[model samples]
Target: MSSEIADAKPTDLPKVSSGSAVVIHPRWVRITHWINVIAMFVMITSGWRIYNASPLFAFTFPPAITIGDALDGLPGALLWHFAAMWLLAVNGATYVALGILTGRFRRKLLPIRPMDVIRDLSAALTGKLSHDDLSVYNAVQRLLYAGVIAAGVVAVASGVSIWKPVQFQEVAAVFGGYDAARFVHFFAMATIVGFLLIHITLAILVPKSLRAMILGR
Candidate 1:
């Protein structure tokens, strides 16, 4: 038996461990992710303040979740909003550019067919979605991340439209007009917020993932 084992090919050997550590997120991915998080939070809070200045309807976002009720009021909110907008745009642009140049999207986010989505959704709903590993994003994660990225792009575009309607009149018209553009912007924010809540919940459920992002291993 020992002699036969010695003649066996490497592929015939029983699989061993992949070692104790794996570097999941690179420095750029981790940095961009956190930067986006901070920018997103700042934008949302300040956005609520700006929204209170000209509420969409009888309804208004709760002050508890907004910065409007804090020091500075609407003017301060606008200041924060504008400042974070620049950060979001620049950071997001860098993230996307690097993702492309590094082929990160192609390597990790693609090959996910419609069937993959259904399979992942099924696994997730049935509580079979594995949280034991963080080497690669699951299908649900890939889809959701892609969706959030799209929403982010929409947010930027709609923001630019509302900020300079005359300059981005074409964009406003594409969204059906200024009123429609604002609606679009609001919906984009809602989508982003929804994604964020889900992301946080999952991260809480899977602490390893959070640690991997922070430590890149």
Candidate 2:
């Protein structure tokens, strides 16, 4: 048994090089991703600017420190925020539609089986998992992606709550109240910020993965 184990050929093990180099992310995915990036950036910046209005959850700072004095006065920022919001919304909707229409959603994003999720989770828990270990997404990756998407939706909803508090009184009430909605929005933004840091760290840890996103290899 010892000899057999020692003499086993490396070919018996899964090889990353054997993986296909086909483009995983198509043009639409790339376009939407970059658009979302820009939109998120604008939204965060403008959102911070808007935050300065009443400093919802914290002390109010001057316009010089923040991006804008008020959401309304910062017309450029407001324009950017709203425009980006529309772009992000439309691009996201298009991506979802295309994914469903093309069957890629079922084929790629969805997990293969219950066992796959278990296996991936076990590997991740053991700290033995890598991006190569996943053809699409590991359990943790899928969870995070799902989480970010959900959070995005919530952020959009809460944004509406804040945008038209009078009109969206019911929606605002769902988060407890306007102040509560503001707190939730801020917390959700913080969550995204945390995810971005982790995402960037992982991207750095795996340059090939980052390259894959860029060149769609």
Candidate 3:
């Protein structure tokens, strides 16, 4: 038996573990992700306060979810909003740049076919979709990530247009006018918030994915 084992080819030998760890999320990706999370929370709350200053909608976000001071009011909210805006903009830009440079976007987010989306949506709604593989995204997941990235860009552009209408008049004109730009910003924020709700729900449902993000394994 010993001689027979010695004569066996490498392929004929029993499989043994290599003992290398698998990484689902890289260090930079995890870092940027958590940073963006912090920035988003601040931006959303402060933005709600800013919107209350001159609401376009009939309803307003409750003060419970906003960041504002009774002493400083709008100016205080503006301060927080601007600070979070810079954090998000810089961090988001870094994420995009790294994604493209490393081909992460192409590998993970591209080739989102309509039929695949339809099939996945049906499976997801019926609670039959498999998320066993944390590394591979379903078609619906791909579409949502791509859409939210685009929405973030729109939010930033529309925000700049509203923040400095005189300087970014061309940008404002692209959205129609100052009033139109506000509408655009509001809708962009709504889209982001909606995406966040879905994202959080999925994270809770698939705790392993959250673990992968936190531990990168």
- Counted clashes in each candidate structure: 0, 0, 0
Cα RMSD (angstroms) for every candidate in the order listed: 7.5, 8.5, 8.4
How do the residues 125-168 of candidate 2 rate in per-residue lDDT, one tens digit apiece? 78788777333677667666666776877888887787788998
User: Considering lDDT, which of the candidate structures 1 and 3 is the better prediction for this target?
Assistant: 3
User: Per-residue lDDT of 1-217 in model 3, one digit per residue for the tens?
Assistant: 5864565455433333355655667777899999999999998899999898889979988878899777636888999999889999999999999877766676678779999999999999999999987767899999999999999999999999999899999999999989999999999999999999999999998999899889776
Best by TM-score: 3
Segments in model 3 whose C-alpha atoms lie over 4 Å from true places: 1-19
Q: What TM-score does prediction 2 earn?
A: 0.72
Number of the top candidate by lDDT? 3
lDDT of 1 by residue, 101-217 (tens): 766775567656788889989999999888776766788888988889899999999989899889889988888888888889989999999999999998898888899789877
Pairs that collide in candidate 3 are none
lDDT, candidate 3, equals: 0.87
Q: Which stretches of candidate 1 lie over 4 Å from their true place?
A: 1-20, 68-72
The better candidate by TM-score, 2 or 3, is 3
